[model samples]
Target: MTATAEPRVLKHQALRAQLETLLDGMSVGDPFPAERELAERYNVSRETVRQALRAVLLEGRIERRGRTTVVAQSKVVQPLMIGSYTEAALADGRSASRILVGLTQHTADAELAAALRIAPGAPIAQLERVLTTDGYRVGLETTRLPADRYPGMLDNFDHTSSLYAAIMARGIDFERTEETIDTTLPDAREAALLTVDARTPMFLLNRISYDQNDIPIEHRRSLYRGDRMTFTTTLRAG
Candidate 1:
C-alpha cells in the first residue's frame, strides 16, 4: 500500500478506537453524539467519522434505534457449548427470557426423518420462540425433535424455563452438538421478530445435538441479531 493510503487507514482506526473507548463507559440508553459533533470533537472529516461508526457498528458495540443512535452493550458472547440460551445469557451476567411463538407437532418429512434417524412420517415437535435479554429481543430460535423420542415433551415442558432441563426431565440427555454459523440480512419475518431493519445483518446458527449414544436428538436453527450477539471459539496450542 502507498504511504498516503496507510496514514488514512491508521487515522480511521485510531478514531474508531477512540469512539469505542468513549462508548465503553456509557449505558445502553445513552444517546450517541451527532455525526458532525463527533467529527469536530475527533478533529476528523464527517466521512471519517462515518467510517469509524461503521466499524464499531459491525462489531456490535452500538446500534441505531428509530431516529437516534444509542449505546448498546457489547455483543452477548456465546461460547460453543451444550447449554440453554438462558444459561448462555446468565453466564454473561444478564437476565434471559423468551416469548414463545409456537409449538406444534407435525409429520417428519424425508429430510427431517433422516436427520433424526426416525421413520418417515413420524411425529415431530417444532418449537419456535424469541430469546430476549433486558427486555430487548435479540434472537429467534426454532428447535425440532422427534415426538416419540420425548413423549409428551410439550405437555411437560414449561415454555419459559430452560430447554436443557426440559429435555433432561424426559430422560433425553444431550451430550454434544455440532453447530454451524452463517450470515445473512434479515428477511421481513426475521426483521419483525428481532425488531431490526430488514437489511440488518444477522447470524444464523444451525445446531444438531446428539445423545450419549451419538444419536441426533434435536435440530435447532437460531437467528441472532448480529449487532447484539457475538460467538466465541476456543483454541489450544498443539
Candidate 2:
C-alpha cells in the first residue's frame, strides 16, 4: 500500500492556526516571537513559518514596526451610510482626528464643473485632510464645494472640525449621496502622507452629496487603509 503525502498548503494552514491561537493570548503592541524562534518551537522550517505569518499580517492581526512584528489593534468598523469619519470612529469606540493638509480656492475645471453642476471657471474651495484614528494615520480625504455658495469658507471654516457639521451649521443638510467604492494602491505622495508602503492596498471612495432641493452640495474623494478599515452596510429584503 502506498501512503499519501500531506499537501504543503495544508501544512502551512495548520501552522497558521497554531500561530493564531498563540496570538489570542498576546496583547496589542506585544512583540511577536522571532521567526527563528517560532520555527524551532513549531519544529518546522523557517520558510513554513514565513508562509504561515503572511495571512495573519494581511488580516491586520500583526504589523511590522521598525524591525519587529507585533500584535496589532483591531480594524475600525465603518458603516456604509451617510456619516462622517469622526462619527464612524466614535461608534467603534475610537477617537478620530484630522491633519489639515491644504485649504484653498480655485476655478473649477470642466470635470469639477460637471460634477458640481456648475459652469466652468466657477469658484470652488478645496479642503484636503489626513484622517487619523487613535493617533494612527488611516485615511486621506479631499472635499470640494462651490465657493460662491459658501462664501468665506476658506477664511471662516475651521478645517480641523467636521465638514458635515460645518455645512449643517450653514442651514444646508445633506439629503442623500451617491458613492462608489473601489480598490487601489497608494501613490508615492499618498504613501508618505498616510505613513504606509507604496504597495499597500487602499479603499477608494468617491461621493457626491445632494441637498433637499436635489442640488449637488459637495464632492469628495477619500482613500482608506484596507488593513485598518472595514466597511459595513445593512441589507433589506423587498
Write candidate 1's Cα lDDT for 144-210 as tens digits: 9888878776886678888878888767788888889899888888898888878677899998999
Tell me, by TM-score, which candidate is best.
2
Report the alpha-carbon TM-score of model 2 versus the true structure: 0.88
Task: Find the 10 residues in a row with the least total lDDT in model 2.
Answer: 152-161
Which pairs in model 1 have colliding backbones?
A: none
Residue 103 Cα positional deviation in candidate 1, in Å, after optimal superposition: 1.2
Cα distance off (Å), candidate 1, residue 175: 1.9
Instruction: Tell me the tens digit of each residue's lDDT in model 2 across 2-114.
Output: 87987565767889999999999999999999999999999999889988887787677887676788999988888988878898788789999999999988899999899
Per-residue error for 217 in candidate 1, Å, reads 0.8
TM-score of each: 0.85, 0.88
| Candidate 1: stretches off by over 4 Å | 1-15, 21-25, 36-50, 236-238
What is the overall TM-score of model 1 with all chains considered together? 0.85
Kindly report which residue pairs in candidate 2 clash with one another: none
The positional error of residue 34 in candidate 1, measured at the CA in angstroms, is: 3.4
